[model samples]
Target: MECPNDHILLSSGLKGEEKSYIFRPRFNYSKCTKCSLCRDNCTENAIVMFKEGYPFLMPTLCSGCKTCQLACPSKAIEEDRKEIGLTYVTPVNNNLTLVTGVLKEGEERSYPLVLNTKRRADIMDFDLEIYDTSAGTGNHVAAALEDSEFALVVTEPTPLGIHDMKMIMHLLEKLNIKGYVILNRADLVNDEHIIPDYEIIGSIPLSDDIVQSYVRGKPVVDAFPESDASVELRRIMERVSELLW
Candidate 1:
């Protein structure tokens, strides 16, 4: 019943051997007809035959991939909501809105919240839609970036940055989305050949003004209009506008 990511309770006796899993499956009693398909198809055998002949889930063994729900023709399985994250929408300006999804600390599942946030944004008619994805190419990030027209991958000129940048570039190509790179802190180390395949739309050098703008709780463009960083951002905006409009 214990998977690699599971936290198993290493106690003696049958009752004390239960494990606590991050992803737990909830069975719907009213919708289930004791088809036994869920049990038979589950290679993990997480669903066991109950005394009532209905399906009982050993939550510990469940991988939480929702495969059992797909197997059930009646659609009897429902994933229990764990309140893993919260989405917030705030007005940025008359024309722009900011939607932020905050994942609960120590939570593994964040993609649902990302999807919810995107759905909220999609329902509203807007002139432009920007999906600011999180770092790394996890399912959560994919959920946010999926179907996006363009992904602005911001990275520094370093070995680690180049490595992760290449990974996301490949991911974008796999998703059939055009990607652009904004070399952040370009002054740190300039290597134009690092991500040679992806287009470099704009570059922002390391600057005290850029740091100060962030510290002052404002966008660099709004805080330092004539700063080099702000200029690069404006150039990026113009490019985006040309492509989209």
Candidate 2:
């Protein structure tokens, strides 16, 4: 399938006045006095000392954790803000829009980008906002799911998948968000007894329709609405609507 004629991709940029600040260290040559303390104590090796008795910061190696600033006895290090990522707004249709957050290359932390993306999306008008968070129950995922009313977790029927699903269930419970599970490739295994306590909303069986739809870059519900997988997905959506609306 091809994109609609009216669909357009826009430049990624920050929208609001609020900025995300990371602890990028800036050195004051006058106040430094060739102490070498900031360079000597940097665990990331981001600070390098030159023969001229001055410290230089390697931008890529810096984690912006302020370790160098705290270690600087001469108080020469100053906190500077740097752009770590960009958020994009894409209009899917008249009724739908997609907001995406992408971290800059070599940046490790994604929480700030996710937060900024959420803020950008929050300003837009929408009756419902659906968040498709990244896999795993890390702090970034938690940050995305913080204000969510419920979470629909999709998992495969496998040992490792079940273990990870349990971890996510625990995280959702801790966050006080109601959780529901949907088993993908349900026909591949008969291990339902080991499933977690979360309610199983739908079980999608392995289907060639799903595979072909994925290969064609089309949704199964749109490409093959009568297919078994699509039918199950519709049921799941109905359940979700009942719970949410």
Candidate 3:
């Protein structure tokens, strides 16, 4: 994951004091000896030095582009990759393999980690894989959707849900991936216009069983196989399999 100019290496994640490979200006300034190696080797000339000879970073001018960091022999430049979090693979009770990417608190670049998790999942053999994506239609969501054969976009029945669903639908269309909408709190709003064209794969009511299962770190499908939510989830998975395979 080295950036082209060799200034930055794509970090796997931070471990204890070890930082990720992305360039963090704050850390760079603190560690730099002002040897001007970064300035001399900078391809984009994005680095600006003060009269005191300290480097000033203009991230807007920066393409996230790593050129200056590579030229610096001091190795002062670093990134917050560890802050992004790591991808974990765990085996659940029903032989379901759970691949999860937990973002570090206050970390901004969540999608890259999600992308990494998905890539890891691709290499492992499993009967079924489920991605519980972060809320919102952003880069993280987009990256998660990239390799997914099918997507279950869960939403509530409200103006906000419809608005977000439309955005996600547009994204899915752009990616040429088909998805089904699952109304989580179906009692809140009307279904008349929510997902008129697409199939309503399944619905989960706002119920205590769902909440209790989630609190106990259990999938509703596995926790209560006979429950309505569990039955619907299985049906949705079946439909998704047909669409994908």
Q: What's model 1's overall lDDT?
A: 0.71
Query: Candidate 1, residues 1-245: lDDT per residue as tens digits?
Result: 00110011111112211112234557888998888888888888788996667888875465566677888988888777345555555664477566556666666556666766677778777767877677788877788788888888999889899899988988888888888888899887756566566688888989899778767656778789999999988998999888888
Let me know the TM-score candidate 3 reaches against the reference structure.
Answer: 0.68
lDDT tens readout by residue for model 3, 1-245: 11111111111222222122234444466678988766666666767877668887665344344566666778788753234455555543356555555555555666566666677778887756666666677887788777667787888888888888888888988888888888887777755665556768888777677777766556666567888777877887787778767
Q: Give all candidate RMSDs, comma-separated.
A: 10.9, 5.3, 8.7
Candidate closer to the true structure by TM-score (higher is better), 1 or 2: 2
The TM-score leader among the candidates is 2
Q: Clashing residue pairs, candidate 2?
A: none
Local distance difference test, candidate 2: 0.78
For each candidate, what is the lDDT? 0.71, 0.78, 0.65
TM-score of each: 0.73, 0.78, 0.68
lDDT score of residue 243 within candidate 2: 94
Q: On residues 44-161, what C-alpha lDDT tens digit does candidate 2 reach at each position?
A: 8988888877999998888777888898888888878788866667765578677767667767777777777788889886789888787778887898889888998888888888
Give the candidate number with the greatest lDDT.
2
